[model samples]
Target: MTSVSSKKCNKEEYSFVYGDEAVSYEVVRKPAVEGLSHQKSQRKIAIKVHPSCEVVVIAPEDTEREDIHKAMMKRAKWIYDALKEFRGHLEHVQPKQYVSGEMQFYLGRRYVLKVVEDADALPSVKMTRGKLLVTLTRFNDGKTSMVRTLVSRWYKARAERIFHERLSELVPHATWVEGIPSFRVLPMTKQWGSCSAKGSLMLNPHLIKAPKECIDYVILHELCHIAEHNHSEKFWRLLTSVMPNWKEVKSRLDGLAELYLNE
Candidate 1:
């Protein structure tokens, strides 16, 4: 007969004061390697501060509680700075008013909204010259929701067409990846895009507002997940193989979030 013992894992949450702010974070312990002694296995802790300002700490199964605390304290300044910057960006985000001369973002460029009323013309939205030309059959007071809905539909249509085109252009470069995954454009509150274990990708419609390169970076990032699911070392190496300047592009996308996501 063979005897076996199972290892137990659990997650704990802790709060700490940083720069006069109470910051809470979660600590998780999970097995990282198999057939290795606990002392010999990788024990380094990993910390991530998400765009939504959520902090998570992942550590080896046998890591000490005090060590996690020490690590958090060491990185306190970096965490504080990131939170401050994110808050500053949030402060500037305001809902769209859909009025003429109001700024709208498209392909990393700013365009002024120009609402035109043409009873005979079809209700449509397009870029004429440099401005976003929104033509409607009639304009009345308290019709902002109608205008917003029409513009939203137009953006979604463009996102569907352009995202597919870009995916077709970039997928060939990833030789190791096989089969084109279906994608959908929708609004997401916390993430720009995500690839599910199933062969489908969900992209934020707001992404259509970003630069072409930034959009490419995001698509490639999700595609790489088909090859490597987790954000492990292998996943990043795969992403870099395709887009070496992904970090710079990612930064630009994050900065532009304030403009597009607020709407």
Candidate 2:
């Protein structure tokens, strides 16, 4: 989820007005590769819109500026549509205020958060009477740092336990995996889970807010990476073999990601 755009020294920047919006984009020239033929070297211009709303154009070195502009203009509508979608996602994932009556999620279920001030009670968090209750011995209604801390800790603990349990159930189906690969629970802004080159996995704690099947989909996804590191055809094939309807599950997860990845 954390994507840091690389700074390119040799790049050209341009901006054009599209309706009421002024769109900015950069073009990075691509050098001809050694193995590529002359015709292949004249590659078509490639346009990419990043999650951070960065628009980048990759083009052959010999491509004229005017030609690049034409290509960009042709895709301007698509680019703007993509940008609007990501911007909406960013706006939706705002930080929580942790108010007593605020709603919270767990395992795809909603719970009303109730902060209770009990001078003699120890600080604790628990689900009681269908509510996520936070008991504070030294509660201050004005400051909610303690509430945030307690709720986050509880989420991390549950994520660690549930993620491991789901991984266990799905790993047996991933015939390529050796054993239960080590994994860590962490908070990520834009990723549900990832598999490292060393086969270790990182699952976002917020993902525990999703349903059990969704969690299994993410775990199975990383497990597929153990054998096929890159997202090549084989990688996707391996994933589909294990979870036949993975595409449907993935789309369902994508539809609910904005809600689940909340603070």
Which candidate number would show the highest lDDT if scored against the true structure?
A: 2
lDDT agreement with native, every candidate: 0.82, 0.83
lDDT of 2 by residue, 53-142 (tens): 788899889877777778877887898898898787667676788878887888988898998889989888998887999998875654
Measured with C-alpha atoms, the lDDT of residue 218 in candidate 2 is: 92
Instruction: Summarize candidate 1's per-residue lDDT along 95-204 as a digit string, tens digits.
Output: 88887877887888888899888999988899988899898888898467767888899889989988999999999987766767799998998788999998589998
Where's the lowest-lDDT run of ten residues in candidate 2?
1-10
Q: List the residue pairs that clash in candidate 1.
A: none
Model 2 TM-score relative to the real fold: 0.64
User: In angstroms, how far off is 252's CA in candidate 2?
Assistant: 1.7
What clash pairs does model 2 have?
A: none
